[model samples]
Target chain A: MERKSIAIDMDEVLADTIKALIEEVNARTDLGIKEALLDGNKIRHFMPEHEGVLDEVLREPGFFKNLEVIQDAQEVVEKLSEHYDIYIATAAMDVPTSFHEKYEWLRTHFPFLDSQQFVFCGRKNIVKADYLIDDNPRQLERFTGKSLMYTAAHNIHNEDFERVNNWKEVEKYFLGNEEI
Target chain B: MERKSIAIDMDEVLADTIKALIEEVNARTDLGIKEALLDGNKIRHFMPEHEGVLDEVLREPGFFKNLEVIQDAQEVVEKLSEHYDIYIATAAMDVPTSFHEKYEWLRTHFPFLDSQQFVFCGRKNIVKADYLIDDNPRQLERFTGKSLMYTAAHNIHNEDFERVNNWKEVEKYFLGNEEI
Candidate 1:
């Protein structure tokens, strides 16, 4: 089958953004919690319960600079590239100084994320993509094609998007094989 | 002056979202320049340079859980309410669970924020407001009535929404110093 193009949102889907956010906050605040005690399932939206913990991290001199890539994002993206033209689309707006760092992170994580394929856009609605993988509920309306919503711990209100609980389901849906 | 309605976005204008985000990332990995050293002047979009830092911070848990509020947001919002109806129009989809805390934060910061006139919405573009104060670039197009762009470090793109930068300008353009 000829490869079709797919636009993927970077924050939560390709990157374990929420997880990283939580860790940084904990580290900054010097909070103590077992690693297993926190997971994707725990943090949803901006929970007040987590505010004290987060504030501790933010108070540190430079807490928001370092973030980690989602596990297996590179492998998943590479495999998907074999069957689809991939475009990285993020709503993270203009902060020109950070563009290179953001782009390089994508390349490092996805390995195949090249300049040609990546697009930092303000409006996801304007982009033309056959498929989109996103964690945002709003992005679902923007897609006319198959839009896969990566399942997250706190995506309760975003159940409207077609849910793919894990990489295996994503593989099955896009590649026609579920045993990922 | 008769009080009318108002809506606002939180990150840049109300709080130091970008600064905090940058700080959080740098602290975790020691990747790029320390958060304080970053000169965000020419940058339009958050790119690869910052991505390296972002990748590091994201590895930590609970980063986003601790986003800080804008400095003068409470005071400004209170003062604005003295002359207009105040509503919070945020693009943040995670407001439901976090609304109370956010609202309480606002109240703690400014008592006037509690007076029965605020709305927490996921889709600000679709919502109706007599006046809108936001930092997001695309939101300028979505607003119908008097739209004001809150000026801040990360919101340099908001220069595009120059018609209304502060309440003084908003009054000059929208209210016209005339009693409603």
Candidate 2:
């Protein structure tokens, strides 16, 4: 049987991006904002100056390279890869400069996946897959397939799609009681 | 009426890639290969050393940044953008390093189009649009929408799909009698 393809988002879904951003903020300033303090909101909301600082960091060349992977992401995604076709669909166009970093990041973290599995674009609606795993509700808005919302602090209130809080839940949703 | 989206290819369709590649070969070695002599084939097919030299060029940082645009592509694509939702889709995954250069190239040549319209991916099958105007037949193979094969020296023998010989024909096909 042909394995069903799954399009996975990189930022918060696979990589703990907000946490990294928060860390960058803490390292730069005395904001000392913990991930827990974010409480399902972006840093810009709590940032004192705001002034596009976070956006500026995102536009930097290496911001996306060293992002820590979400908990259990590697093992679960490897398991999922065995059962399904996996495509890493990232909206990298929003920060065009991050392309090389993001590509290198994916190559380092998701080494099993090749360049063919990467899709760097702005709009998620055009991605063809049996399922789209994303955190942003707007990214899932126009998707024609099954939408699986990956739980993140910022997207906690979005109740429109099936939510998977962590990689364990993702494995359960896709693999369903199969031992990993 | 909402404009029907067209996913246009960047290589042979919008940019004269093979011509540039041939030029690169002539610059390096004594292979006096001209675009017409090859008569619808790739640079590697005629290259004497053929030992991944062209692939090396493709993988370089700035190769895609300076290639010449296909004649009339700017005017016709600009005209098409007004009538159709234009998306510049390039298979940049084949050369991951080329992402930044490709984005910069697009920005320089097609400034009217924004980041939202750029898709740098490997598989053309995943791109959803009303029509995919491309040069590679394999790219059109899995596309579910209408496929228009843009003429190129290499793809001349391809008999599949409606062929658009040049940007003029592309304008004629889409805009028809409406002046471009």
Best-performing candidate as measured by DockQ:
2
Residue-level error in angstroms, candidate 1, position B178: 34
For residues B105-166, write the lDDT of model 1, one tens digit per residue.
54455555542333333334433456677766567665655666665544544446654555
Candidate-wise lDDT, in order: 0.57, 0.86
lDDT of 2 by residue, B34-110 (tens): 88876677667887576677887787667898899998999988988888988888999888888988898999999
User: How well does candidate 2 score on lDDT at residue A127?
Assistant: 83
**Cα RMSDs of all predictions?**
13.5, 1.8
Candidate 1 chain B, run of 10 with poorest lDDT: B35-44
Highest TM-score scorer: 2
CAPRI tier for the interface of model 2:
high
Model 1 ranges off by over 4 Å: A30-66, A94-97, A178-180, B1-180
Cα lDDT of model 1 by residue, A30-147, tens digit: 4554434444344423455566664454344332235566666676778888878787776543232334445556656666655556654444543456788887666667555677
Give per-model TM-scores. 0.43, 0.95
